[model samples]
Target: MFELNDLRQTRFYQDVFAEGKQKGRQEGKLETIPQLLALGLSIQQIAQALGLDEQLVKQAAQPKS
Candidate 1:
């Protein structure tokens, strides 16, 4: 069972939630990588800047070309 508590009052919960949200946003960005690459972004460039795999970048570029 779970009860709704004021987790926000604790610094630990706040940090954890913030970190989780940041990670979620990062994952969302990764999901959109293909779309971003389709918009004429170079794979090497994307890979270098985003720290993503070049092969993944290439895959993303494929749908556009």
Candidate 2:
């Protein structure tokens, strides 16, 4: 039988895994921002099309250091 501490650790790991998946999905969407921009979509338009924040889209459009 699982102890309480074991159950808590399992839940913590599950939460972390779920968060990683979500971040990966967001990164994938961010990676698409430039392609959408190349297609002539404005930041606002891209955000609306992708259901992302306009600011986040703009940041993604910027060249990375």
Candidate 3:
């Protein structure tokens, strides 16, 4: 009695996926931030390590001051 029709929640799926992606991005930042800081990597190096754009890395690396 397993029917695929029971899984008709498109919005729910989207929300779940979005949340997962957001959490993953946060965790990745948490994991990479220290490496970047420890190595004293430039924005470009940090971006390369994370396979992200240098601008994105720079934005992420901005000090909290």
State the lDDT of candidate 3 residue by residue for 20-65, as single tens digits: 9988986787468656777877777777767777776666666667
Q: Pick out the ten consecutive residues of candidate 2 with the lowest summed lDDT.
A: 4-13
lDDT of 2 by residue, 1-65 (tens): 87877875797878987999999999999999989889998999999988899899988999999
For all predicted structures, in order, the TM-scores are 0.55, 0.79, 0.54
- Report the poorest 10 consecutive residues by lDDT, candidate 3: 1-10
Question: For model 1, what is the error of residue 44's alpha carbon versus the real structure, in angstroms, after optimal superposition?
Answer: 5.2
Query: lDDT of all the models against the reference?
Result: 0.74, 0.90, 0.71
Sorting all predicted structures by TM-score, with the top scorer first, yields 2, 1, 3
Model 2 residue runs over 4 Å out of place are 1-9
1-65, model 1: which lDDT tens digit per residue?
33347666678888999999988866775777776666877778788878878886666556553
Sort by lDDT, best first. 2, 1, 3
Count of steric clashes across candidates, in order? 0, 0, 0
lDDT head-to-head 2 vs 3, winner: 2
Greater lDDT among 1 and 2 belongs to 2
